[model samples]
Target: MIEKINLNNILFLDIETVPEEENFLSLDDDMKQLWEQKTQYQRCDEFTPEDFYDRAGIWAEFGKIVCISVGYFVNKGDIRNFRVTSFFGEEKKILKDFSNLLENHFNQAQHVLCGHNAKEFDIPFIARRMIINQIAIPNKLNLFGKKPWEIPHLDTLELWKFGDYKHFTSLKLLTKILGIPSPKGDIDGSQVAHVYYVEKDIDRIVIYCEKDVIAVAQIFLRLRREELLIEDEIIHV
Candidate 1:
């Protein structure tokens, strides 16, 4: 199946998000209540809503996208280029820009959206965030009427599973086993909120997001038993 799909037609991507507010104390009464209720299932008895606030970025309702980095393959005769681009800033602006990119570039029958566990995380998160930002869903994201098989999403994690629903794999772990260089070095998903809130470093986050995007594509290539692209082959757009 991997060999049959055109790598050039897929948009490989990843996202970075943070809590809507830097601190729980910054949330209004209504938001506070909503967040507390939302985390009830996972929140431990000892931790208050404020204690769990740092994880808000994982939930679309309590979080906002800080960065969205995407890459796509372009075949040019003897050379192959994978161009990566990023959208970062205020959530509304990021969402709007990403939506426009999809609508203009990848909104076609031949284009498939691919990422590591994107179907469960990135895709739904982007769709929900776009809705919250009051932006119209792009053709690629508007999955309301599409049949199960009609959806064009291709998840590297899902592909790795090979129909084993009980198995789950992280991008980092998969890349390590596949002999691909680790996209994550010192920082990780858990530190994103702290980096954005405390360090105020969106650029760092964007770099990390782009690495994940590249890692996702590399993982897909690995699944097809193809050689991963070297750094020079990756172009930043």
Candidate 2:
């Protein structure tokens, strides 16, 4: 059996993504034709090398991080003190700085990295962007060769399965089920891109990302507490 891990080593993180640029909407003839055929939201109108630069611009304008919020909870014998940090600005620098901080300050003592849907989204996204910028990924996050189950990851969404993959659960729904107040506020995921693109408000994106991190953390805590009571009534009666 795998040994139980100390939660302190785990860093829970989430990121907010937006289209690279406004001008990316002006695509080449073939791409424009493809975009024109798709429905409004379904269109990939903002994808291009130029759009990547636009994303870089937003990253610079916001502080280099496109809104990455990480929550670290270390158990201090009796209680856990959760420290949350929001990273914004240039993707490369912010990622490098955070990687260094994690290695020098956090990685040495931790047992594992944890997040909600992190394996599918957050981790790879950060790793790929780091590669794009030629920044080395922290050793703690270098999981390219690791086996899925063998990897030291604790995804609350995966834990919800409890080894039985029957139903799909979202963070919001899980939080609601556990009686944990949803931190989403008035902004949903669909609105995130628009808020970043139209409003150009980095603060809003930061707040939104922080809320998601908190929600994921809460879900983890609730699961640990065995507070995830299945609503059998909703399914059986």
Candidate 3:
């Protein structure tokens, strides 16, 4: 049944994001209140352009994405053929180009978007940036408002939940639990912004993103196999 879902009809993606620059923050009082309450990070004491810039700098210097990697896996008989591509450039340009590529390559109505923690971070981040850029948001990404189980979205983190909501798990930790080789070397997510800012090396960022994509693919394979084994055992028993 899983195989019948057409693996080619899925797009696996990941994104990196940074905070808005000080000049970028022209938030009204209401907007500032909402943002301070809703944002994942801490809020500033005052709402000045300088404070906003410092906030953005904090993200640019640490919290934001430096690269986004996308992977497509299509089942070819016994083999799962995968193609991994990375978009690394100025954040605005990369987001624009990447959005265009997705629109051109896949049919929004047909393909299921897949990612690890994408629903929470990647999708929203991309969508917000697209709005800021005045780019059309893809229909698939527009499903963010839908309930988790209602949407066609497949977050590996959510899938790992099975039936119970017990604990929150990171992708790296999940890889270890599933015996999947850790693709992240000594580099972790926290260091990504620094690497991109200080080294100004797009290649390193690309490599880091590519490794994450590979890690995601490996995790998907392991989960699929585990599910198959469980199904087969149930059938026999």
Q: Residue 182 of model 2: what lDDT?
A: 78
lDDT per residue, candidate 3, 8-73, as tens digits?
A: 777777765444422334555665555555443453454543344334523222234457788776
Ranking by TM-score: 1, 2, 3
Regions more than 4 Å wrong, model 3? 1-4, 20-65, 144-150, 226-237
Any residue pairs clashing in model 2, and if so which?
9-110, 63-89, 63-90, 64-89, 64-90, 65-88, 65-89, 65-90
Q: Write the per-residue lDDT of candidate 1 for residues 111-185, one digit (tens) a residue.
A: 999999899999999999988888999888888989999998999989899899999999999999999999995
**lDDT (Cα atoms) of all candidates against the true structure:** 0.91, 0.64, 0.63
Clashing pairs in 3: 16-65, 17-64, 17-65, 18-64, 22-53
How accurate locally is residue 214 in candidate 1, as Cα lDDT from 0 to 100? Answer: 94
For candidate 2, give the lDDT of residue 159.
81
Instruction: Summing lDDT over every window of 10 consecutive residues in candidate 1, give the lowest-scoring window.
Output: 38-47
Candidate 3, residue 60: Cα displacement in angstroms equals 11
Minimal lDDT window, size 10, model 2: 228-237
TM-score for each prediction? Answer: 0.97, 0.74, 0.73
TM-score of 2: 0.74
User: Which residues of candidate 2, in runs, are more than 4 Å off?
Assistant: 1-3, 26-65, 164-167, 226-237
> Which of the predicted structures, 1 or 3, would earn the higher TM-score when compared with the native?
1
Q: After superposition, how far is residue 133 of candidate 1 from its true place, in Å?
A: 0.8
